[model samples]
Target: MCYIYSRLFMFFSLLLLSFSVYLIILDFVYIIEYIFIIFNSVNITYIILIDWMSMMFMSFVLFISSMVIYYSEEYMNGDLNKNRFILMVIMFVISMMLMIISPNLISILLGWDGLGLVSYCLVIYYQNIKSFSAGMLTALSNRVGDVALLMSIAWMMNYGSWNFMFYLDIMKNDWIMELISYLVVLAAMTKSAQIPFSSWLPAAMAAPTPVSSLVHSSTLVTAGVYLLIRFNYAFSSSLMNFLLFISSMTMFMSGLGANFENDLKKIIALSTLSQLGLMMSILSLGAYKLAFFHLLIHALFKALLFMCAGSIIHSLSNCQDIRCMGGLVKQLPLTCTYFNICNWSLCGIPFMSGFYSKDLIVEFMSMNILNIYIYFIFYISIGLTVAYSFRLTYYSLSGDFNFISMNLLKENNIMLLGMSGLIFIVIISGSVFNWLMFDTLIFICLPILMKFMTLLVIMLGMLFGYELSKFNLVYNLLSKNFYSFFFSSMWNIPILSTLGVNYIPVKMGALLMIFDRGWFEFYGGQNLSLLLKKFTLLQLLSLNHLKIYFLMLLIWIIYLLVQI
Candidate 1:
């Protein structure tokens, strides 16, 4: 059943990819509307915007989803709930498609909320405490974005239509539009797992690997980036700068967190957060096209990365600790190859898919005259990205095998087959995407030293990663040491966003409950009931007094008539 569905989605992916190519070749944009409502002479339509961008995005999304479903055939083999998992994945893909094609905010919100709800379902699919907690975190965090989208919808209602595409140009000068832009950014930040919202992405690792690969790596998290891309025209300069700052911090935070993270899936999740920050930061710089370009490229490598990690985990009987894995290059060579390719690609190794996007971002930023803080954050984030990449590599790929000696680590061909579909693209998509996305050369002028700075930083990060990996003093690490615990705990964001955010409100609620049950209850309801009970005679008289009065009035009227 999963196989059939996987093949069907693959067919759809190929068809869309071909169509996207045609659209790109022609530089065409197609918009069609289905007017479903007529009120006060206004035509409210459900709008579908089909252009190169939507088509391309839809193709990539379908491609990754198909691969994930196909891989699950083997990865989820013998699991009773495999069919249900595949179904949920298909529903997720449909939701992403709905989001991709729709120009109307209402339809987008439906798709947005759909992704959140289905993801929560998928996250808790394992039916365990950890999975349930992760699901709750994911659902609650995502609810913030859903609420933001709802607010955007409500605010845009004043325009008489939910189709925000038409109003982008005019919104630039309007205060309401500026407010909408902030709401949209807030929505984007939550969905992308930016600062204050970063913990959930890692926690979502409690989900199955396929879910991690498809949802966290590519689809669910990127929804915010796609939304911003669609609504790019409405951002004011102030909002853009604010977004820039937030995304930079998020980028740095996630990169730092990834280095300290030991769980295989979680490290990748943090990397996803970092990449999302890059996308958002570049988008804020008004290079939305570049952002979208990076987005597609990142999806390819990261999805493959997660798939590769899933293969490893599935083979290892669900073991996810990096410390427990080492020298896997000897046993699972192909999977390791795939993993390394994706990892260094993520590090922006030259000529790889990640290289095109990341290098371009750094160089593009260098050309701009930004403040020193932005430059510092941007470069440090890049270096931290490389540091974590190397750290992951040193721990898992190069060391002596640390797992149990009696284990069999054979490769699963079906999983590889699914991954193979993406590996080819991961290698060549850098050059291919660069060509397709840019019609002309992006002329970046920088000095020789500046050009080498990226490479220099990457090398430095690699050295730092190696040193961290070799440092035998285990007690000095982030989660252990008091000083570095801040970085290890993601600046204590998980603590803050969860316990910190909830503590006061929850305490207030407890106090309120005490007041309600103890005092307010007695004062409002119980006391009133007691007073009524005390006056039982008057209560009974009150109940019958109306009938008695009516009878007396009738008697009086009869007497009066007789007298007259």
Candidate 2:
């Protein structure tokens, strides 16, 4: 039965993959046609290749989506909802395609909303309480971002007309362009999990591994970086300064948060936020190609890391807390091996994919002496990444293997295969994908040397982490939830006024205490009554009917007065 189901899943996945490729081909054909029309002095309503950035973005979506579809087949192995998962994954790819190929704001919005909706469904696929809550948080947070984007679109339509090609035409209007650029950056920061709006991503770790793989690595989060690059031409100098400041701040804070996290997934989650901040900073400097290059490399290594972590957790019967894991190298050799490779790449080790991309970003910023401060932040972030990566690696793969309860190590062939493939991709990305972007000598050499220096910091930090583990000082800080404490304190004003009071009432009253206690029946009855009121047609009619009757009576009285 399993074999039959696997075969069916493979068949459907291949079909969708083929369709996505065909769509890419179709988009290229249109691009070529539009280009030909432009050169021939023909009347072209839509601008194709408005800039090389657009073309690069389209190519990125095509390449990443292709990789995602291929990877999903192996990741979703043996799941009953395999078909449904594939469907959403394909829809996500298609929406991304639409976003890059969109000639107008309306088309782009359709793609944006489409991706958002499908992502919500994918996040909640586990259907548990935690998954549902995470999904809700993701939905709410993204909706706020989406509203900003929608407002920008509406503003453009009113002032600049509905034509998407207006961006190219209105490039000279500095003030209006800057205003629009700020609005777009606001949306991008929210979507990319930058500071002040980053809580959703750590919560989103409740999602399944493949979903996390997709969100962090390739699809949803990439959209924000893509947006910044796409609108690079429209931004003014002041806007760029603002972006650089915010991006740098986000990088520093998120790295600090990652350093204090105990959960392996949340560490990666925070790291992703930091990496996106780096990419945004690059984009702020108008280095679109470099930003996109870093985005591509980060996606490959981060996904590999996440999947490797997932494989370890699965083998240990879903143990995610790094404190519980100790010395798993021998038992899970493949996972440990891949995790080490991915960690090195993530920390920007010399000759690795991350080193090449990250060095380029640093060199791009190094053009100004003041930008060295930004480089300092990047250096600090690199050290922290190495520390956490090695901490995770050492705790899970190098220490004594006494804490784990599970003895039978069931190897997940499909998961391992998927992870191995990503590891292979990361290994070769510097050589193979290097041709995709331009790199200077400084870009090439600086990151390689820095990687070694960063490695030393990692070694020292790991020793510190190990010693602290023995004392268990940091473990308590990690488990007591460092990030959550900061978040609660930051949002304490509203919580104190509303949520705190609500909880206080429950804590004080006997009836409310019973409801808050394990006796769910007390609230269950009230909930049922509310549900009945919501669903009953008579209640709906009374609500709408009363309003309509009032309107009719007002109109009758007006008619009588007019007749008199």
Candidate 3:
């Protein structure tokens, strides 16, 4: 069953890939616009904007989803309901496609809602307590974005249409439109799991790895980036400037969290969050095209990275804690190779897929005279990325074997087949994207110091990670102090997001329950039932005699005769 679905997705991906190639060759933007008139002066229009960007993004989504589907066959081989998993993944891909091609807010909302709901379904597929909690968090957090989108749609009604693309130019100067922009930004932030909403992302890792690979890495999270890209024109206001600060903080926070995290999947989840922050921050800087560039490139390697992690987990008896993983290179040589390639690419190693975009993003930021705070945050986050990568590598791959001796760690052929397809993309996607997106490549002139700053900080981070891993200095220091628990637990974001986001509302609900069960139930329902029962008992016991009925009838008759 899984094979059939996987192959079907692969076939569809191929079709989309071929269509993308044809569109690229023609170098033409095609718009198929249709309007359905329901009544007088009332119509819902459908705009299918087929441009190079949309086609390319759609192709990538389908391709990665296909690979993920194929990978899940082996990874989820033992599951009784793998077919359901495939169906959910397929539904997710369809939603992402709907999002990619639409310029209309209504269509975007449909797609956006689909993504959120499908993701929640996937997250809770395990049917366990952990999965249920994670699913709730994921669903509610994304519901914020859904509500924001709905509000934006309502606000757009002021213009008598939900075609936001048409209004992007006119809406820029209008304060009312500014409200819509703010709503959109908030929506994007939640979809992308920025800051407070970020707790759902790591918690979502309770899902199967194949889901984490496709949804978290490439499709669902990037929906926010795509939204910003579509609405880039509306973001030239103070709201966007404020968004830049928030995004910067989010980026820094996620990177810092990744450095302290020990769970292998959660660390990767944090990295995804940090990269999202980078994309959001860049978009806030009005570098929307550059942000899109990073989005695409990040998707490629990140998906591959997650699959590699999945493969590792599969071989290691499903243990995801890096503390219990080491010397995997010797056991699963092929998987380790893929893991290292993806990991290095993630750290933005030169010439890899990540480098082309990440380096350019940094240089672009450096070229602009920004506030010192933004500058520091950008560089420090980059350094932190490298630091965590180093720490993860050291703990999981380089150290002595932490797994049980009897554990078998052979590479699964089916999983490798799926990974091999992604490896090709991860290698050439950066260069291909650079050529396609930029007609004339962007060249930024930076001071020599600034030019080398990214590499220098990365190197410093590597040193820091290696030393910290070898000496146990950071662990010891943190364990002994207040900062240790805070950093390790991602500043208690998971606790605060779950307990904080839900606590007050849940408490209020409990109070409401008490009111309903105690006062309302007793007085409104139980008392009424008791009073009826007593009345029925009195009628049966006291009024059952025929003499009573006859006496009442005679009194009624005498009163009627006197009135006559």
Candidate 4:
């Protein structure tokens, strides 16, 4: 049943992809608008903006989702709720498509809220405590973004319309209106898991790999980046600089955290977080197109990377600790090949998908006269990317076999079939997207020293990774220090978010309950009701005798005679 439904979605997705391809070839933009609701002067409508960007993004999403659905057949072969999983994934893709086409804030909420809710469902699909915890975190963190978007919508009421496309140019001159960009950036930060919101991305690994592949890699996480891309025209210089700082810190922090992570899936999740930071940072630098370009390319390789991780995990009986894996190259030759290709692309190796987008972003950042902090974080994060890539590669493919015994690790054909599609794109997506999106390569003049900084850092990172892998006592010893605990625990953001954010509110609620039940209800409500009852009884008692009624009648008669 699951297979049938998955194949049906794949077929439908392919058809959508074909339509998108045709739209892209013609360079056509199709806009559809109709009034959804009208109240006095304010009119909310359904606006779908379909252009090269939307069609391109939609096609990519459909293609990847189709492949993910197909891949899940074998990966989740015996799972009882495989159909539910497939359905959730398809719904996720639909939400992404809605998000991709809408230019209106109200319409965007449909997709954005859909993504947050569906991702939570998918994350908790495993029905375990870890999934529950992770789901709550993922949902709550993204909920912040949802609230921000809602606030932006409310703020947009100043313009008398929800369609931001019409207001971007005019918004720049209005200081109060420009505040929407800050709200948008705040929303983007949470959605992209920047800094304080960073904990959820790594914890989201509790979800199944397919969810990680589709939701985390491309759709759910990148929604914020996509939103910023749409809102790029309205961002003030101050907002951009602020976004730049936050995103830079996010990129650096995720990179540093990845270096200390041992869980294979969490490491990849951290890498995704780091790449997200890069995209956000570039967008903050006012290069929306470049950020969008990287978003697409990163989606390709990161999906493939997660799929490879899933395959390896499936073979290893669900083991995800990189320390437990070694010398897989000999056992899972094809899987290792795919894994390395994706890893190399992630490192931004020349001619690969990541290089086209990532290297250009860095080069452009270098050419711009930015602050020293931005410069340092950008370059260091890039190098850290390579460092973690090497560390992951060494631990999984080249290190001594740490498994207890020789184990069977045959490649699953169906899984490989799904990966094969991405593998081809991982190799060609860069050149293809570059040709399709840009008329000419972005030109930047730099000295020889600057030109090769990325390479130099990558090499340095490799050497550092290799030496650290061997001489780990010092790094390990350093990791035991107080600051190390902070880094390893993601600066205790998870604890803060879960414990810190939740504790005060929960405690306050308990105190409120005590007040309500003990004092407020007893004295203010219950005792008040009892006092009213006693007063009524006293009034009745006062009128109990027939003489009292006669006395009242006589008083009324006297008052009437006096008035006459």
Candidate 5:
């Protein structure tokens, strides 16, 4: 049995390896496509090859999926769920691949929904109540975004046919085009977990570490920014500027939340959201190339960080609360090493991946048509980013190793080696991609100054954090249910007044609800004894039900009646 199991495992491992090679080949093909388009040798629309952004995205997905597949051999240790987990991982990769290559709106929506569904399953793979609840929250949040996409699709079909080839042609209708663009931005915001939709991301930390690393850092959360990049030409200037403001706000707010988080996973979760917000802000400026460039760097280092966190948790037998962790640097040296590399990159230190990408974003903000105040927002967010990165690195790895028992410090070289490789890549990513696009004076020097300023802020924040640890004031304020409070407060407003009295459906909703519920129950409960009474009432309502029961009943009932 052991021999058979080993053989089967080796076979599957080789299959995953082969897939990784195929993905690398695909990445090269995408690069060639970009070159072709750049020189006008091939029309960008005619070509079906993946673009640069998608290629980078696929590379991260392939790397992380391969790592997870290999790591699962030891991590699962003959558990029954091993097969199920592997299957989900493969499905996750396939969905992400579909998402990357999808060329049109309908295809993109299909891939997007597929990814959301698969990610939810992976999150709830352990069957724990908390995990299940987290998955549901993710699903609910994603569904809201899905509805916006559907509305955009409806608008598209109404203006043109179901054919996406008509998109460019339909652009002549400015109002319709702008409306579709607004809906698309709304959809992207929800999917990317910006502002009001951001709560689901931190909640998603309830999933297993591997799931978190893949979904939170590399693939799922990126879908929003990907959409924004894909449809860059559709949005109006006003809408783009609005998106820029919202994304910058999300970046700052999420970084603040990360600074206050106690759980290891929640900190990374918020950081992922913040980094994505930064990417979206760049995308909103029509800087698609730079946004994607930053996305590639962010994915690599963030995945490395999450995987290192996973290794730490696994070594300590699933302990993830950072407050309980002290000195782990000595005990988990390999993990700590990778964590530091990721932190350096995330903090935008010199010669790191984030320095190149983040500096470009700041440069773009400064040089773009945006106001100086907007640039200031981006600048302050950089400090917040550094502060949170330091908070994560210091509290988890630097304090004292004596806090964790010696017996719990088992090292898995496979996991450690995987993370180390990612860290090495993150260190050299700038040179590998030629991401340094600006002047040395502006890009390197200014960012270094910014980095030091940010570092000082981080140190001060840590000291304040230490003091607040005693009084628990900052911790409590950060942890307060701000999202819940704001949502509840918004709900308390009179919808009719807020939306305009003309927009309100009026009190007729209660009458309809009573009628529909009573009618359904009455008809459903009828038997021979009450059949006559039920039939008489049903006949009276049949005229009304006629509109609901036709071949196009749903459309008329939902659209026409709602409008009325």
Candidate 6:
């Protein structure tokens, strides 16, 4: 079942990948529209937009899913529910495809809801307490976006159609339309795991590694960024600027969190969160294509990174802690090679797929007349990204062997085969995509020092990474302090988002439950029923009094008759 599914998906992925290239070459868009529903003058339509952008996204999603399933076949070989896992993956991809191909708000909502539902299922795939908690976090966090999308859909009714693509140009001028844009942005923020919504991304790592690769790389997290990209026309300058700040903060937070994170999958998940912030930041600068560019490249390397991580965990008997892993570059050279390359790309090392996107994004941001604070935050975030990447490399791939010496680690054949498919693309896809997507290069004139600043920060970050990863008395002492706690916990975002976002609502729900179960139950149920019972008793007593009066009258009449 796994073999057939994986092979069929691979063939379709390749076919779609090539066809997206074809669509780009031809510069064609094919829209299929059906009148889903109509009322009076409104013609509600179900629309499928086939263009290079959508096609490219579809191909990337399929390619990654194909690889993930192939990897999972080996990774999940012992599991009884491997087929179910594979099917869930297929459902995830289909949900994503529905979002990617549809321009209609309603269709997007259908897809959007599907993503939230299916992701919840995937996250809780493991039958454990942690999985259950993680899945709830994932579901509820995304439910915010679902509500936002639904609101946007409701707001679009004023525009006379659910096909939002046709009305983007007018959304900025009309106040109501501006409201819609804000709603969409809110939805995007939650979906992409921005700020308060960011906690779910790492928590979602409770799922299997293959699902992690797919979710982190393309389907779930990217859904928000893609939505914002499609709705780029609707954003006012203010909303864009707001998104810029939120995304930058998210980038900084996640990068810092990853440096202190020990769990290998969670660290990768945090890094994915960090990259998403970069993507959102670029999009806010009106570089939707560039954001999309970053998104695709990220999807490629991130998937490979997860697959390699899966292989590592599989070899290590399902161990996920980087602290317990070290010097694996020698024992598992091929897997580590893939891991390092993906990490380097993630770090935006030159000639890497990530370099093409990050370098361009940074340069583009530099050219703009932005506030110094935004600039500082952006560059600092970039530096932090490098720092964490190096820190992760230091712990996971280098240093002395930290694991049990008896364990013999070897790569799985199917895992290697799956990973190999994405390796070539991760290396070369950036240049190819940059060439195809941007026909004419963007001209940027920045000073040399600023141009070199990115590299400088990279070096500094690497040095800091070394210092940070070093184990010593002072380091150990500091590790016990508040700073470590703050950074490691993603500024306590998970706690705040879960307890914080839920604090008021959960309290309100409890309050409401009190009303429902305590006051309401008393008044609406028990008390009312008790009062009715008393009223029935009173009526029965009145009848008894009448019967006694009648009996007394009958006795008096009998006595009078006997006296006569």
Q: Using lDDT as the measure, which candidate wins? A: 6
Model 2 accuracy (lDDT, Cα): 0.69
Clashing residue pairs in all predictions, respectively, total: 0, 0, 0, 0, 3, 0
Per-residue accuracy of model 5 over 187-248 as CA lDDT, tens digit each: 88878988667767877787777778778766788888887777777777788889988888
lDDT of 6 at 487: 90
Candidate 1 C-alpha lDDT tens digits along 72-167: 998888888888889999899899889999998888976888899999999999999999988999999999988898898899977967878889
Off by over 4 Å in 3: 1-27, 35-37, 473-477, 506-564
Q: Please give each candidate's TM-score.
A: 0.90, 0.74, 0.89, 0.88, 0.73, 0.89
Q: What are the lDDT scores of the predictions, listed in order?
A: 0.88, 0.69, 0.86, 0.87, 0.70, 0.88
Clashes of 2: 0
Candidate 2, position 271, lDDT: 82
List residue ranges in candidate 2 displaced over 4 A. 1-79, 158-172, 371-375, 402-404, 439-564
Q: Listing every candidate in turn, what is its Cα RMSD in Å to the true structure after a full C-alpha superposition?
A: 14.5, 14.9, 12.8, 14.4, 13.8, 12.4
Model 4 error, position 547 (Å)? 79
Q: Model 2 over residues 200-263: C-alpha lDDT tens digits? A: 7777788777678767986788887887777777887788888888888777777766656678
Model 1 TM-score (2 dp): 0.90
Model 1 clash pairs? Answer: none
Q: Number of clashes in model 3?
A: 0
Candidate 4 minimal-lDDT segment of 10 residues: 1-10
Candidate number achieving the greatest TM-score relative to the actual structure: 1
RMSD of 2: 14.9
Which candidate, 2 or 5, has the higher TM-score? Answer: 2
Candidate 1: residue 16 Cα off by (Å): 1.5
Model 3, 1-564: lDDT tens per residue? 666766776677677667777777788878787877568767767888888778778877877887888899999999998788888898898899899998889988778999999999999999999999999999999999999999988888889677787889876898878899899988988999887777888889988999999977678899988998899898766877788888888888888878767789999999999899999888888888889889888888899899999999888888988888988888888888888888888888889889999999999998887889999999999988998999999998887998788888888899999999889889998988788777676989988999999999889888987877787665766666767677767678889877877789988997678566786676677778887877785566575678777887999999999999
